[model samples]
Target: MVGTQHAARILVASNRGPVSYALGDDGELTSRRGGGGLVSGLSAIGPDAEAVWVCAALSDGDREAVRRGVGEDGVRMIAVERPVFEAAYNGIANSVLWFVHHLLYQTPLEPVFDEDFRGQWASYQAYNAAFADALAQEADRGAAVVVQDYHLSLVPAMLRERRPDLRIGHFTHTPWAPPDYFRLLPDDVAEEVLGGILGADRAGFLTRRWADAFAACCQTLLGATVTTTPAGPEVTWRGRTTRLGVHGLGADGDFLRERAHRPDVAERITALRAETGAGRKLIVRVDRTELSKNIVRGLLAYRQLLTDRPEWRERVVHVAFAYPSRQDLPLYRDYTAEVARLAAAINEEYGTPGWDPVLLKVDDDFARSLAAYRLADVALVNPIRDGMNLVAKEVPVVSDHGVALVLSREAGAHAELGDDAISVNPYDIRATAAALHTALTLPDADRAARTKRLADASTALPPSRWFLEQLRELQG
Candidate 1:
């Protein structure tokens, strides 16, 4: 156990850690480092920062590592019971909360908060309690703790109750549903979720729009008093105030530019160019097949483009990378299949002897994605709702020849990138199709200029700085 002897002055809590372990055939665990805002932020703070990352044991190897007390320095992995973790993580977080936030639920036949849901809710509570207990044990007096995403929404309050001396912050990486949409959760559950987040000293979002939506929910449901400040908004409930701040996470431009030029990525670029054919313009979209990504609608819009504009036939190819996400949930698995089905349909309808209208890859390949970014003439990023679509930011940074961005207004990235992008309504397939056409036809100089501006906006708040700023704000 990482006890008081290793108490941390700074702490980060999330469902996933910066490193994961895989058990080899020989029974040795191989550790793989992860990359994201949190990992980059922690690394930027340096090794001697006295920071500890409290995360769950997400895999069998992770559980085994917990048993063996084998982990990277400044990391504490809690081995929650498998059933409990699943019920909370998949059953509630991914299945319930994700659907609610993203507005992915079908109104006629879903979200029945029955006995099964109650059981899952209990597990969710236990899951959060485990994290809260672990964080309370590891935090030093007045330590600053940042909890990540919806998976740990309840942790801030739970931890606050346990260690009032600690300064805790909660950042939601998903969109905050509008008050009406948010109330879809059972009355008690809605209040509980809002109250849990309000428990933080600071609650952070990816955009001002989402932050406002959160405040509206608190005001409408919890009767929290909200006030505007120079920094941002503050929601006070039960005589405790939680300040809300917006931090739009940006692309690691230096990393993407350097990594995109690697020999491996170059090889992929060549291969993709060859597969796409000579003199053919490329439209690229890279995304996890999360339901909210609106991959199907994007494909439908592309099909519309082919139907409406025959002149683009054999002249343009859409390179789509729809990697699987949350396959443990049946809904996600079905969405992935639907994506595949539609991609195949587009090819069948528009493909020719020399031209394949859409080149679809379901497997995840970072090198390939970077290659696509470099080769894209148009970058399609149409999400139903996103906290911030990093793909929208990254393509511009990595594009060798600047790519025109067809962005969705619903994405959090739209707040920053909309002015320079050909913004479209995600649900409007015809409008998105028109936007893609406009992007494809944009003059070279115009596209290049827009891309440069987007690249700048996208890197305005890099991952390390984003994390540090939040940490600083929490400490203050």
Candidate 2:
């Protein structure tokens, strides 16, 4: 959607790029394009639009490619030393920023910020500086640079210092912790984060609640002046005013439909269809095994449903795909093991020779996930807190037979889909179980109507338009 002349001036900086290269047995590097909102947004800009994707080298293959100067034509990758990258990525970005934003750390004993954390914090800054330098070097004069997610939160401020003529925008794809919880971060680090983000002309969040949370952090922590206006929330610090904007990134309906119809997806659908017996309803949940996903609670709620509503037993199947994530972190590994353990216990308790109560798959398969979306009768997305649970939006848009959504009130998707979904408190297993029962029993007519409305709202702003809208705001 970018204008022809302006397209060349647009640059996207993020932790990962649209494409990655892998070396094959024959010694040829193969390029593979990624999927998801970020990739879709970049692709929507049109192939001829002279855009560049700046990203960090994630794998040894990527680093080798960087060394060989063999990258996807449009991507510029920054390859830091392995130790530095690991500490910056796992130690700070994932362990600290991700946990803080999601409020996952327990206040009683965790997040010990000692000498070790300070060392990692320095690496985090160096890692961010690498990105800032890459983006600044590649971007054209007066370019519009959009930095994404918590990984590169410092890039906006760093890039601003080097390229003042460029229009900079930073978007957070995670929930912003409230002021009190955010104060858990060391005072200096918290202030630095606020100052880094405020360096941009515009700071964007997935929901207004999160945007307000960021504004409150600036006011309380930095003692910065905050003012609300029709334009947007403005934070003034040391004479510079940065606007805060909310943009809920929506599902790409056309892309999902097209991909859902692929041959591999059809094959997966046939395999899943065999698992789903006749006369049984399907309950589908797809998620990465992230701590904030509350996967264990969702499993507990499903178990509760079977216990409380025994009539639905053997009449319904819970198809959950918990793709592995952050396995390097001990906490995530233990959490994943717990998820497997719970699913096993549930199967042992209620599964029959003819019908298994739960079918849990931990492998990553996009085609299988899409197949589940198409056939889901009920879609469960009960994250404790989420920026925007795209699975909540994706299921409604792709459901062949209408799906009843059991959504979490804390999810950003609830802002748009709450009216249609059976909402529940994420912490209440009983309430979630009740909502699941309500979703499964809803009349087909009402379910269809609600699904239609949800599909409309979820697809309200496709990736192309979402990117363009934010670009317009930053440019303004």
**Candidate 2, lDDT over the whole model:** 0.90
* lDDT per residue as tens, model 2, 38-77: 6777677778767778888887678778888776656788
TM-score (C-alpha, index-matched) for candidate 2: 0.96
Error of 2 at 330 (Å): 1.0
Which regions of candidate 1 fall more than 4 Å away from where they truly are? 3-6
Q: After aligning candidate 2 to the native by TM-score, how far in Å is the CA of 97 from where it should be?
A: 0.6
Clashes of each: 0, 0
* Model 2 residue pairs with clashes: none
Assess candidate 1 and give its lDDT: 0.93
RMSD of each: 1.0, 2.7
Say what the RMSD of model 2 is.
2.7
